[model samples]
Target chain A: MAAGEGHRLHRLGLVVNMVGGLRNLIFPLIAIAFGTSTLDFGYLLLVGIAILFIGFTLFFSWLAWTRFRYIIGVEEIRIESGILNRNARSIPFERIQDVSIEQKLIPRLLGLGEVKFETGGGEGDEGTLAYVSTEEGERLRELVRDRKEGAVATPAPEIANNDDGTADIRRFEPEAEPLFAMDTQRIFTFGLFEFSLVIFAVLFGVAQQFEFILPFNLYDIGAWIGIVEDSGIDIDAISWGARIFGAMAALASLIAIGIATGLLRTFLREYGFRLDRTPKGFRRRRGLTTLTDVVMPAHRVQAAIVQTGFFRRRWGWHALKFVSLAQDSKEEGSHVVAPFAQRPEIDPIMKEAAITPETLDIGFRRLDWRWWFDQWALLLPFALLPIVGLLIFTDVGARAALILLLPVIAALFVWLSWRHCKKALDENQLYFREGWWSPKLTIAPQVKIQSIEISQGPIARLRGLAEMEFGIAGGALSIGGIPVGEANAIRQRLLDEIVKVDFADVNRG
Target chain B: MTDCAGFTPTAPLAIEEMDVNYKGFGAINCLVSAIQQRHISNMDEATETEELTRLHPDHVKVTRIVASLFMLVLIIPAIIAETAAYLNQESGPPNGVFIIPVLLIAAFFVLFMPWRRYIHRGFHMSADRIRIVRGYLFRSDTIVPFGRIQHIDVDQGPIQRRYDLATLTVHTAGNHNSTVSLPGLLHEDAIAMREEIRAHIKRDAI
Candidate 1:
């Protein structure tokens, strides 16, 4: 493996670019289709353009190939790129948080891996080696890891020119033990339960693409919705109230399709999900289509969040994500620790992250009941205003009955949310629990908190209520509609804990 | 100094005594205070690397004008429609009359925003962290530790460029509220702040 000098990405990187450029080629093909029949010899032009497109892809790929080279310096890793606009960046070894080695289909087929170096500093990956042989990727990761570890241990590193250099290789191999495994069957079930909001968008895009590509006009799902509305299911049938039956059916179908596709996606991405604990960090290997292996070091992870949908929570199923600098599988900035987890599974995982809320019987302070009223007031605009407007402006009939049901459901949602919300302080960690249907519990260490605050609105002030909010690494969390005294106490506690300054001394001024 | 080992307040200041002195509180004040609650307590003061710096007061004019221009741009269609409707009497009463007051209210916000920000928006950089306090009604004070800050950017809009002022945005890890923006600083100050912060981060690797 090339070590000292700057090295360019593998020649296969050009092929990777060509494969990526296929999407760009589609526009020309689309234009050709649109211009054809009207223009003479359009097919000939299209053929010529296809060749040109591939040539264009190759030319640009070559430019990118030549321009992009990374120099693994003794102290820092330097990446230089751009043809017309020359750009270069040097990320020091200490700054680099983690190195993730990923292999997509093409890369895997070619025995290559994409290495991304992350520096908790958020400007995205500090540096990325687009395509390298799997061995080279591992070697590079090991070399970087050594430098990073060595830098912390001693002021300077001598391992690069060690007597045998066997120490470097030996330490790379951590005693990894299998901690969690989500087999295909479990993943399938997990996927079915993992209903995402993205499905609506996916369906919309797919429907449009299908409409354009298909020779025959496909059934208009929108028309089906209209048909249901026109069916005139008895509005007077109060016992069997199905006023918004059509809308409900449409939504149910959408959810059904979402679950099905979600299942396929889950199977495709996490077919052989496995989690292992290594000396370095938590080693995770999953993905069927694009195999990914990422090491979530103990230090990089900011917090652990356990989230579950209303229905999933009932069946003791939850998804766990770690808020970290690494932009995991998606650009979520959240690494899904366990795609499908329950209280038992999550307890252990959270414990590993030092956020074990299981054994600790921390007393939680519930928000004032007036929080429900505030939620209702907030929900009124989306629920009641529309209903009132419809009732006042339009003829009140079957639609009115359905509109009335909206506020009722919204009220119940608000009530449930109000009941479920609680904030607890467990010595070093802050446990924030919210949601009724789709509950989310966030565990943030108090020392990690950057700042603390207490605020109140006119209404809240009048009611002797306030909100206590605290900021950690990833984001901020608030405990709203709490008693003013409680909020102040929480605020003072957080300030004292986070900042070394005496809250009493500071407040005296 | 009290050992703050437990997650409990050691301060003995009467709870009621700590109530916010909401003097001259307006919409902007409430807004800033609300947003501020997510970060630092009202008692927290700015901590700068050198010394705390407030935004240039002239920046208010730049932001106000820019915002008012945008509001005016939105109001143009309504004004045009109203005039067109007025010319054509057969179209009955002007359809865009209601839009005037709405746009005016929006314009009020545009005017109010910059004034409040000019008064309250300030930033500080310490040896280990950079602090920013913003919002007039909803005061928020955020401190980004050197280790946590991902990157810093100095941006200048046309008005800002003309005024020789720039906005500095410091990004931290993990997306949410990642970018803390401090607008209305001398362009040189913005650049110097960026460099200084970058240098500190580099020096203090941890």
Candidate 2:
């Protein structure tokens, strides 16, 4: 009754959210420490303050839960919320792109879900109905979807199930076909091949915080050598014995364990990675603890980026992602279409998105070599100065001088990347290929380009080259070192082609 | 495709001269006086005064004033730091530091930046497209098609209002260059321009 003539979140909303808030408090608690050995009145006072802070937070959450409500009218959903300063917004069903029902671990355990309305406006995810019963969430989503169907002109079949209807519907979403999915075995395989570096980072952070926790002081190499000398234990390579061998064996197992932990994390994150064809588009349901259901509508996808890491390339495996409007992606403006896919397996997925071989047939054009070597020459001082300084100042100069090879390797890699970095433009699609170690091939439709910027610095002016940047609705993809003439020509041609788009293409992807 | 060494185009930014002859990089004849002359389209050579409209000339004066204010702000920090150091001799840097003069001399060149920007800055509003050009050392020419414009805003600052000037910003559907700002237009002209474009968009939508 206090929440007006609209539905409130599930009864356990306050309890669930309070638990989540308490979990977040763990991070801050580490920063605010009390010396247990010196416990007194001050400690009691600090404890009391902490309790007050937590109590205040819970009180606010309770107020927010009770006040927040949304009513489903005929054409619009009116959401009213706020504990202190009230906020109200009415979103028409037609404007609601998709009602994304998310079931993270906590919500799933409580039989609750959060339904996010990704409205077409650039302002974040337009609205969210948090902590609804999972069954009620399904019902609410169905209601909104039916309303949307009735709101928009139904028989516009040519733009078949396009999420945004921003561009030409080259390919329609196939009828709810169970497309590609990862099995538990292959999920583990993908996890095995993938490496999560977060574990080492977390361990290193902990080691830094609690020096006593570390087996040895990592920074004190001189002290270590002194100990080794005093102990009459020679672990030196030149005069090695069984002790050196033991150290090597320990180091090897440590590396193995590190890799094993990384594999475990990858498994947990992508435990049930599955991609299925939904009525609107593709719904990807993945994760072990916090299950995420990301729906990528056909038209909303701006561009396709296929990336293959050095190790993965050897195995003919690549990861592909699509740039979209919503903030559903872990990576900004992009959602992973396939985490680990073979080249052959990716071909069909690309086809489903309407990025075909013919569209990519435009011969790749390499950037001018001056853009490569000129930057290298300017960057050489910054790269070499530290090594030169070390040689001049530090006793470890002779050892650090070996780092000179790193720049050489980096320059060699840059040369290879220069060879690989190329752009191709056709009537409808634009493709760019970059990277030597991990090649990324990005292909975006011409209609998706928001604007074209042809710019040149004084150096570029002298060379008759420019930086050509193509802006999409979500993320921008740019190919530098384009000849100024070619860039302008491409711009004009793109503009002319853009004018010829049919009425439906007026929207933004 | 195999060897890139021999690959070269005749003209860099002037590709396909037939289509973009009247309208592009080469259209600017002089670095300094070029702002006075409007680019004439080669296609409509018979009608010598081409289609593209130039921005109001008062724009230069306004921009120059803004640049001077910006330069003052930039120089103030260096001046204050040097003054403070000179006042506190014991804790100060090694004496006889004429850093203020040295910084001013180097920073003086920045005063010319606004002039160059003014010379390059231009906007043309036609039936189908609105083009805004800005920058001097690094130039960016943005062409926003009428069909793509999501919204149009006409805004005026106190300084601009005193001079009866307003800036028109056209926001397009594309996220990139979603809003292109064209400053230094007569206030009435800006409103009229927005209404004209708005009417055309509505007409085309149906």
Against the unseen true structure, what C-alpha lDDT does each candidate score? Answer: 0.66, 0.67
Candidate 2: stretches off by over 4 Å: A1-177, A212-218, A222-244, A327-331, A357-361, A384-407, A502-509, B1-53, B68-111, B173-175
Per-model TM-score versus the true fold: 0.58, 0.65
Interface RMSD of 1: 9.0
lDDT of 1 by residue, A157-207 (tens): 434555765557546666445777897778878888866668778776898
lDDT of 2 by residue, A312-368 (tens): 788888887877754455346778878888877777887777666333457888989
Best by DockQ: 2
True contacts kept of 2: 0.27
In model 2, what lDDT does residue A335 have? 81
Per-residue lDDT of model 1, residues B95-198, tens digit only: 66757786777757686566555555556666656666554334444555555555555566667878888777765553445567777888888778876766
